[model samples]
Target: MSYTVNCSILLTDLPLLERPAAAKAAGFDAVEFWWPFAGSVPGDRDVDAFVGALRDAGVQLTGLNFNAGNMPGGDRGLVSWPARSQEFLDNLDVVAAIGERTGCRAFNALYGNRQDGCTPEEQDELGVQNLVRAGRAVQRIGGTVLLEPVSGADAYPLKTARDALGVIAQVRQNGADNIRLLADFYHLAVNGDDVAAVIENHTAEFGHIQIADAPGRNEPGTGELPLQQWISRSRQLGYSGHVGLEYRASQEDPFAWIAAWAHV
Candidate 1:
C-alpha cells in the first residue's frame, strides 16, 4: 500500500529542489516527477543534484517520466515525432542512467501529439519503435515503460485504458514484455470511460495506478470521484503497484486528503 506524491504537480508553490523535502514533510515517503528538467536530456550534473535532493529528503523515487517535449506548452512526447526520433532514442541512455541511480522502476512515455504532416499510423509506428527500444533500455535496470491516457489531448491518441493497452501489446509483440499501462483514474474519468470497469478488468495489466479527483484535478475530498474506493478495488483485483497522488493541492496542508488512503 505505497502512496507516492507527484512532485511535478503537487508542489507548484515550492522551488523544484525543495519539493521532495516538502512532500516528505507532508508524509509522503515516495515521490514521482515528470522529468524535473525542462529538456529531455539534461546534463549529468543537473541530474545528480536532483537525485541528491530526493535522497536528502529520504523519499523513494517511485515513478518517473521520460523527457516529454514541452509538456506545459502542449507537446506530449518526442518519440513519435519523425524529426525527433533520434533525439528520443538518444535520451534513453539518460533515462536508464537516472533509473539506475534512483532505483525507480517505472517510466511513463507519453505518445506525442499528431503532427501536421505525419499521419496517425506513421506516428504510431515511430512511437512504438522508439518505445520498444526504450523498454529494452529500462529493462536493463529492471524497469517497466508505462503508457498513459491523456484527457483533452486532441493530438494525443491514447485516451483510455484500452488504448494504452493496445500500444503495450504492440510493444510487447516487438519483444519488449516490460511494457505496461499506467491506469490514471483522473484521465480515465475525464475521458468519460467507466473507471470502475477499467479497474475490474485491467488491474492485472496495470504496472502503475495514479489518482486525482476528476473535473478539477484537485485533492480527493474536493472532487466527486471515489478515488479511495477505486484504489482499494484495484488492489483487490491484483494490481500491486504504487498509487501516485498526481494531483494539485487546493488546501494549505497539501496532505490533508491522506486520510482517504487508509479509509479506502
Candidate 2:
C-alpha cells in the first residue's frame, strides 16, 4: 500500500508547482517527479518554489529523476553523453540538495540515447563511470541510484530489466554498490519482458517500481495489463518500496481510472 503519485504526469491541468497540492488533494501522501525545472541547475528561486510546494502539499518525496535534458524535445538523459558529462555531474549537486531537504533517497538516472558519433561501447563505458559517481554521491544520504529501462525510444538503450541490471553490474563491479534497478513494469511489458519472471527472479534488486497499464500507458483497467496482480506479486515477494504512478492520463482526471487507488 506504499504508493506515490507521479505529479509530473498525473496532474497536468495544473501548473508545474501546483501539481503537488493537487496530488495531495487526490489522497496520496507521497509523491515523485521527473525533473521539474527546465534547466539542470535551476535558479535559487525556482528551487525554493519547488521545495516549498512539496512542503505546502504535505507530501513526502519518494523518488526523483536527475535532470534529463529536454525531455519534451526527446533527450532521455545525459549520464552517458560524453559532451554533457560535466552537466550531468553538476546536476547531481542539485539533486542531492533536494534530497537533503525532502528526505528522498531514490533517484532515477535515465541513460541517454545513442549518440550520432559515439560508438555504443564508448557510451556504455562512460555510462558506468557516471553511474558510479552518482551512486557514490547519493550514498552519503543513505540513498540509492535507480537505473530504469525505458520503452518507445529506439535509440535509448536499457530496454529491459536484464539490460539495466547489466549496466548496474558494471557499476557494482566498479565499487558503487548503491546502484540498483528501477523496474518500470509498463516499459518492461512493452519491450516484451516477462513481468512475472522479472519479479520472481530479481525482486531483491529493485530499488523502486513504477507502473502504467501499457498499450496506451494509461491507468489500470484502461489497458490490458494485469497491474494489481503484478503489484501484489511484487509486494508478496518482499519489494517494500513505493510504486510510482508514472503514466499519462487518458482523461481529465487520471486518478478516476483507479478510483482513488481503490481499484489499483
Query: In order, what lDDT does every prediction score?
Result: 0.87, 0.90
| TM agreement with the true structure for every prediction | 0.97, 0.97
Model 2 regions more than 4 Å off: 260-264
Q: What lDDT tens digits, residue by residue, belong to model 1 across residues 105-189?
A: 9999988888998788999999889999999999999999999998878888889888888888999899999988899899999
Alpha-carbon runs more than 4 Å astray in model 1: 260-264
Give the root-mean-square deviation of each candidate in angstroms.
1.2, 1.4
Error of 2 at 54 (Å): 0.3
Could you tell me the TM-score of candidate 2? 0.97
